[model samples]
Target chain A: MDQNYSTIGRSSRTKQAIEINKVLRNTYLLLAMTLLFSGLTASISMMMNMPPMTYLISVIGGMVIAMFVLPRFAHSTAGIGIVFLITGLLGFGLGPILSMYASVPNGSNIIMLSLGGTGVIFMGLSAYVLATRKDFSFLGGFLMVGFLLVLVAAVANIFLAIPAMSLMISAVVIMLMSGFILHDTSRIIHGGETNYILATIGLYMTIFNIFISLLQILGIMGGDD
Target chain B: MDWMKIVAALALIMFIVYLFPRARHMMENSPKGSSADWMGFVVPILVIVLFVMLLVQLV
Candidate 1:
């Protein structure tokens, strides 16, 4: 009787692990495709002279729809379709910055630097969480508060029109997003997030913020002829 | 910076964040059916398609 019970427990555990792995695999594949799509969309938008503001609004709209409506109604093959929709929207949203950078003489260099810098920060933060194995979930609340504060300051700065303030906001964004990456990654490893799509979205947003902020900083400091 | 676009993005992000917890709850309560499983691909594909279409039109 004991042996039979142990065997059943082991099987269940294996099943759970398999499910988790499947989710992870799908998340990674989707992430890769999203990145590729973003690149292609940005390139095309630049070629076509799409207005940056229009692209930005579309991205914002799509993000809201994806996060709210899609998740609610998407319970079938349609759910998968929603995922792609979100990814593509993100790509479109990214088009403006990509195009703007491309117009600069050294835009490509700046982009590569931003990408590399974002990658390094992500890997570093991820490594820290993995090595420590300590739950960083506690940081979530703090990060949210910090992010909001930054947002407010950013808005105020627009009216204030202070270059120094802009730089400070960018710095804060980089730090906060780095923290988010660490927290989100830790949540995944600790099984706090069993749904990998959600997990991927969270991580992707963190990385995006980091890259955008870093690019802004670079542009401010070294974007002259 | 266009304030309209910025505000729209901020509003959308806030709305999504507000909905996140509910979405998770729904996912948890729903039966693990194949239909639910298939929805996983829908969002990502839609994202790609919309982006591609937009890109083509823009280019």
Candidate 2:
């Protein structure tokens, strides 16, 4: 009887392991594709030389879709399409800012450096979580608080437009995004998150935030602005 | 100053309003973080900041 019980337990664990692995694989694959699609849209928008204010409109549009449309369709095949659409809109929004920077001295350098920094930070944090398998769910509250604080500061800076304050807010946002990456990845690995679309969204948004923050920091500190 | 800045600020305030309750609930329900967990978060972030500084310098 003990032997049979042990056999059942082993198989159950194996099944669960397979499920988690499947979710992880699918989330990563979709994430890569969405990133590539976003990049394509960004390139197209850049070539068109969009106005700077277009960023606000496109970003707001993307956010509205993400907040309202994504949850309803997350379980369906259409979720994948919606995710691509949201990412593409966001990328298109970014083109105006990239164009602004490209016109400045060493603006392209700042962009490349920001890209390199974002890639490194994302890869490093992800590898650490995958290797250690440490649960970061405890970071939930902290990350949220950080995000709210950053938002408040961001709103204030709209009036202030102080370069120093803007730089500080961007740095803090990058840190908050790192905390979120850990928390979100932990949820997926421990099976708190079962949907790959949602998981990809969590990761994609974090990466997006990190990339933007890095760009701001580089532009400010490098005097590329 | 500009219409874009005004719109941006309003959007940010809305986000803060939208996120506040969820964050409060998460704090109330989620597991309390220990000092070690905080350390785990801070150390990597510090490294990231340093790495970013290095990138700035190199460029």
Candidate 3:
């Protein structure tokens, strides 16, 4: 009976490992596709010089799709299409902001730097979690609390309007996003997150926020000159 | 003061305040991290911060 139990345990462990690997693979594959799709949409809109109204429409459309449509289809193949649509629309919305950054002196350099920084941070932290398989799930709660405090500071900053405070908020956001990269990736590799669509959304948002935050910081620093 | 900005900020604050309790609950229930776990988390974050600073400097 003990030998039978041991065999069963090993088999279950193997099965669980297989499931985790499958989820991780699907999540990364979907993530890469979504990122590229969004980049393409953003580039097209930026090159076309779309108006602010168009950006506003795309953002609202993306949010509406995300809030209402994605949940219903999250379990189906249609979920992938929804993910791409949401990302593509939001990417289109980014055109104006990217242009705003690009207009500043050395703005193009700042944008490229932020993009590179975002890539390095995402790839490094993701690799750390994927290689070590360390469960950073313990960070789930701390990260949530930190986000709240950061939100509070961000809201307060409107009244403050201090450049330093704004810089801090951007830096904190980048840090929070880095933490999320670990937490989200940890969930995928530890069986806490099973659905590839939801997993892709979580990581994509983290990367998006990191890129934006980096841009804000770089914009401020470079603009100061 | 832009009242519109104020209203938007207030709405955002309200939304986040609404999320606070759930975060609190999670904080109480989730597994606590040890020193090593925290170190594992912080070291990479440090690297990111430094790398970002270097990028800023280079530009």
Q: Which candidate has the top score in lDDT?
A: 2
TM-score of chain B, candidates 1 onward in order: 0.52, 0.82, 0.79
Place model 2 in a CAPRI quality band.
high
Q: Distance from true position, residue A8, model 1, in Å?
A: 4.5
**Candidate closest to the true structure, highest DockQ:** 2
Candidate 3: tens digits of C-alpha lDDT, residues A104-144? 78888888888888899999999999899899988989999
lDDT (10s digit) by residue, model 1, range A1-225: 999999999999888778766765666676676667766766666676778675667666676766676767554556656666676676677777777886787776767777776776677666666676656665555566667668667657756878878878987787778767766776676667777667666776777777787677766666331
TM-score (all chains, Cα) for each model: 0.74, 0.97, 0.90
Model 2 steric clash pairs: none
**Whole-model alpha-carbon lDDT for candidate 3:** 0.86
**How are the candidates ranked when ordered by TM-score, highest leading?**
2, 3, 1
TM-score for candidate 2: 0.97
How much does each candidate deviate at the interface, measured as C-alpha RMSD after superposition? 12.5, 1.0, 2.1
Pick by DockQ: 2 or 3, better one: 2
lDDT of each: 0.65, 0.89, 0.86
Question: In candidate 2, which residue ranges exceed 4 Å CA deviation?
Answer: none
RMSD of 3: 2.5
CAPRI category for model 1? incorrect
